[model samples]
Target: MSTAVDDDLWSAVGDPTRRRMIDRLLADGTGTATSLSEQIPVTRQAIAKHLAVLDRAGLVHGATAGRERRYRVDEAQLARAVAQLNAVGSAWDSRLDRIKRIAETIQRTGGGSTAEPDTEHRNEKE
Candidate 1:
């Protein structure tokens, strides 16, 4: 997916309420706004809005079911999201490993204390 689309997806999932809504839909296999609202603390209208955002992000699919629309997680899109998360996590892990190695090298070379002390605090005390 494009970066814009990826950003939208991430933004959609970034909200705690929306993430809980996704969890509810996944746990229940499917849910309507009314049904989800009953389980969640939000109103049905709020749930509908969150669902709309999820739909726009391609995280969930909705279909008309009688008077209300039913929503379910989109497995393929979810997998793609998971893949993106894993990629990001791996990149961070690599960066942290490099940072750890650098810190170890600095400690061994007695360069870890290269920074000056907090002279401002000493001046304030005086």
Candidate 2:
């Protein structure tokens, strides 16, 4: 909502493997490192490390289930991430629109040409 970027959260989701893990957990409703490793290319240990990063970013939460911790997506935090992305995207769109308007104005005023000689540079040389 504030367009504030969560660097830690973004960094956690930046990895393609971790995004795949998130997708897997979301699809299955829950997943363990072992289960995810079976579906993903990474080993169970690597999956566990990636899960730790997600946990630290508040993107996913883990609960002890027998020998392994079962993980699930944090819907609220995920929504927050989505809102941030939308806000940033809207900001960029507004900036681009403003730039386009300025360019159109310049073209209409016939100020977009570069045919004139550089009088300043000529004076400097003299």
Candidate 3:
């Protein structure tokens, strides 16, 4: 039972461009499509498209400021993303720890591998 946030949030942040956009917005406090395009390699239209995706994921919010739309990273949503990432990292750490224990046990028992040759696949020449 994954929530909408869990699903779309990754998709939105998965793009390298969007991630860069988020970084820029965070660093600059706020930015417009034109401003972001200047910092990024893409055009202003592309920046707007990326911003739209981020906005849909609730990672950013935009406010109309005169002629341009100013975008900023949503603190709450960013916090949520960080929490999710931490959870995934913790899970992987636990899995690695278990694997390390298993390896250590095998090493201690000296049962890691057998030196015996395979008789089942022996040829007539053998």
> On a 0 to 1 TM-score scale, where does candidate 2 land against the true structure?
0.84
- Give the per-residue lDDT digits (tens) of candidate 1, residues 1-126: 522238888898999999999999999999999999999999999999999999999999999999999999998888788888878888889999999999999989888565788999989999
For TM-score, candidate 1 versus 2, the one ahead is 1
Deviating ranges (above 4 Å) for candidate 3: 1-5, 115-126
Top candidate on TM-score is: 1
- Residue 76 in model 1: lDDT: 85
User: What are the per-residue Cα lDDT tens digits for candidate 3 across 1-126?
Assistant: 222248689888889999999999999999999999999999999999999999999999999999999999998898888778777888889999999999999999887767676766676447
Order the candidates by TM-score, highest first — what do you get?
1, 2, 3
lDDT of 2 by residue, 1-126 (tens): 455899988899889999999899999999999999999999899999999999999999999999999999998888888888788899999999999999999999988768788999989999
Location of the lowest summed lDDT over 10 successive residues in candidate 2: 1-10
RMSD of each: 3.6, 4.3, 5.1
C-alpha lDDT of residue 54 in model 1: 97
- Model 2, which residues run further than 4 Å from truth? 1-3, 113-126
Please give the clash total of every predicted structure, in order.
0, 0, 0
lDDT of 1 at 52: 98
| Residue 61 C-alpha lDDT in model 2 | 99
Q: How does each model score on lDDT? A: 0.91, 0.93, 0.89
> Candidate 3 — worst ten consecutive residues by lDDT sum?
1-10
